[model samples]
Target: MAVYTHVPAEVLDALLTRYAVGTLVSAKGIAEGVENSNYLVETTKGRFILTLYEKRVAAADLPFFMALLDHLSAAGCPVPRAIPARDGTQIQTVAGRPACLIEFLSGVSPTTPTAAQAGAAGAALARMHLALADFTGARPNSLGIAGWHQLAANCGDALDRIAPGLGGRVADELAWLDAHWPAALPQSVIHADLFPDNVLMLGDAVTGVIDFYFACTEVRAWDLAVAHAAWCFDPGGTRFDPALSAAMIGGYEAALPLSDAERAALPALARGACLRFLLTRAWDWLNTPADALVTRKDPLAFLNRLDAYAGGGLL
Candidate 1:
């Protein structure tokens, strides 16, 4: 349903000629993603995900994403590998968009994650960080503070339409983050978006960490903060689960202990993470076309998280 471009059958068949992945049997549009058109592609050899990078994804960044996936997969992290074409390039053009076939990984994304699942996800995240510690690739987080400011400006008065006083609250939060955000902490390639949907789990073990489009080089613990904002609360952000939070941190620490500075910066980082989502969701709410296939996420869900993070102690 999130498909933005429809790839015709003949075009798909022609594209399959570049890969030795066997002739395409079927290709069904995947409904779960927002930024790219994805398909559950079946071939004579095996099943794979064919992603046609949409407008939001920059063509220049494709190589960085491919390299990151290759690095993580080779490091034994539970991530999908970008299947190279017979020409040895992972990137190609399909439906007039940059595309790649990814090795299919098995598992379901938990709808309502248990503490054990949260713990497993946290450990998997830490492993990804550790594995990418030596990766030479670098990409800036475009949705960082500067991008948040741009979104706030783009939203303008619409923020109040979403919820009263949201614009003011976002402005205040941005100023606070600019002053307080951690600067000297350890840095690495991080999966900036690690929501429940991005992680695929089998029971309590993580089978895959998919959707690395938002991946970037940033403070390592801020990645933990992003996960904390995403996984430690109920879907509506109405209830906090201290046990789940503790378990997540415990699992992460078990894999790679957090530094003292990282520990000290968690609260602010969590607040920044919350604001990042709140701003983006607000922008999307106001801008997405009425007939768009993707669901319009309620920006207020993260506004609740921003408020909770402001109160302190949730982390």
Candidate 2:
């Protein structure tokens, strides 16, 4: 989560009193993600995270996110659990926004992940998928193909400001995705967003995963595609280290046996994943105002990534 909405001291204090987390020692705003406002809250009892929902996250969508966290954490997924208030409600209103207190999970996210680290992350993801297998909750992937089209429409020639020929390239990719995006595959509550930043690692092992806001029910292979795109790529997204990619896939396969169809679909699914990020990152790069608390990630990285996976077979 990011710091879009500023939390005044009094407001944070008022919100903190509702929980048994104890006296607030200090609260610091986090500047990592771009969706919600986050603060690393430290209290006498322990460390916890305080999040205030921002504009992009709909109020109705919070329940699914909260419940998913509850379910996954209960099922032993290494995810942070949201602590309900004294009244037993996990969600509370504060600073004119929906907010919640969550248990803090410790582990640094790897910048350039090793093959073994990628494998650990992948295995953790497989376990998470299994954990939520029986969850009846379903949320449509808003950033699916349709969302890609809308983002592209909004981008409209503005992409050239970042890089010439970028707009046309986006159009071509969107067309290809729409025509060939898979419809039927094993579907489940996939973590639609599984970037490296969402994973926590202690030394070589993944401690837990954070940020379930983008989690949704979708093709299971789609989750692998998302993880492959995130972990395998170098920082610039220009070079994809295949050994890391293979390790991740190998770890995942060890946990859950992927059918031939799913394995074969990796290339196409990876292509779509690349396109999805390219579209969203392009839109955010163009639209997010300068002086915003968060840094806009370069969309060109994902474009390069799409090109790298053009021939397919990441695993």
Residues 1-315, model 2: lDDT tens digits: 678878888887888888888988899999887788899988889999998888877889888988898899899888998898888999888778998899899899998899999999889989998888889899989988888888888998898888999889888888887777776888998888899999999988888899888888788999999899988988788888989988999899889878898988887788889888888888888777676688778888888888888856555
Which residue segments of model 2 deviate by more than 4 Å?
A: none
Q: How many backbone overlaps does candidate 2 show?
A: 0
**Model 1 steric clash pairs:** none
Candidate 1 lDDT: 0.90
TM-score of each: 0.97, 0.97
lDDT by residue for model 1 (248-285), tens: 99999999999899999999999999999998888878
lDDT of 1 at 305: 86
Query: Candidate 2: deviation at residue 103, Å?
Result: 1.0
| lDDT to native, each model | 0.90, 0.86
Model 1 TM: 0.97
